[model samples]
Target: MPLNIDFQQIFLHLFNFIILALGLYLLLYRPVVAFMDKRQAHYEELDRQAAEKDAAAQQKLDAYDARLKAADEEIQRRNADANRQLEAKRQERLQRAQEQADKLVEEARKAAERERAAMLEGAKKDIAEMVVSAAGKLADKEIDPAADRALYDRFLEEAQAAQEDRP
Candidate 1:
């Protein structure tokens, strides 16, 4: 009372301030807080879904890698089989070639032997004819030593000429 303060006016202002604060809390503050909480939950769910998708992608990648490795091993196995087959074919061809060469060599040797036998038979016939001719000439002519030597020389010259004209 001495400082001239009014108690009723102070009480009225205090009551008005409390009402204004309660109205702002109900109309604005409470709705904003609820919207923020809802946004936080939505972001958390999105993060969880992204993590799940990443895990699925990783699993797919692992499966692809395993398939690729299996394919590579299969290719290597097939390649090795092909190489082995090629080697086997090569060995077979080489063996056939060697056998053919041996056969050819044997054939050449047999031909040479046959030719030698034919030559020996021809020489024997020629020698026999020469012996018969010399015996006939000796019986038909006189047995003079000089005449016999001259006849032998003539037969030797004819045999030499026959050999020189041979193919």
Candidate 2:
């Protein structure tokens, strides 16, 4: 009671202050804190979903790139196979052409040999007829066909032997 000090009023005022603080904590502070916590959680969830979507998109892009690369490789492989087949066919055709050319050359050589043989036979017959005519004219008599043929054969053999002796 010194200097009009009021202990009861001070106690009452302190009690009123404590009650008000409790009311504020229940009505305003707690709800505000809970609302802030909910908003933060919502934002975090949205960010997580966005990150997941981005990852999925990136995965899809990687898959598409892989497919594109595979397609390019397949195309290259097909082209190589086609080129190889074409080359093989070309080589086969060239070989066939060479064989045909060789066959034609061989036939030509055989034909030339037959022609040479025919020419030699015809020359021998002509020479034999000339010799028979010359002998008949020198002897003033006709020559027998059989004897002329024998003499022609002997001359042909001697001519063949002489040709064989040449280098």
Model 2 TM: 0.57
TM-scores of the models, in the order given: 0.69, 0.57
Q: Local distance difference test, per candidate?
A: 0.90, 0.87
Q: Where does model 1 exceed 4 Å of error?
A: 1-18, 134-167
lDDT of 1: 0.90
Worst 10 residues of 1 by lDDT: 158-167
Clashes of 1: 0
Summarize candidate 2's per-residue lDDT along 74-96 as a digit string, tens digits. Answer: 99999999999999999999999
| Model 1 lDDT at residue 71 | 99
Q: What does candidate 1's lDDT look like per residue over 1-167, in tens digits?
A: 86868899889999999999899999999999999999998999999999999999999999999999999999999999999999999999999999999999999999988887887787678868998988997999889999988888988897777667654
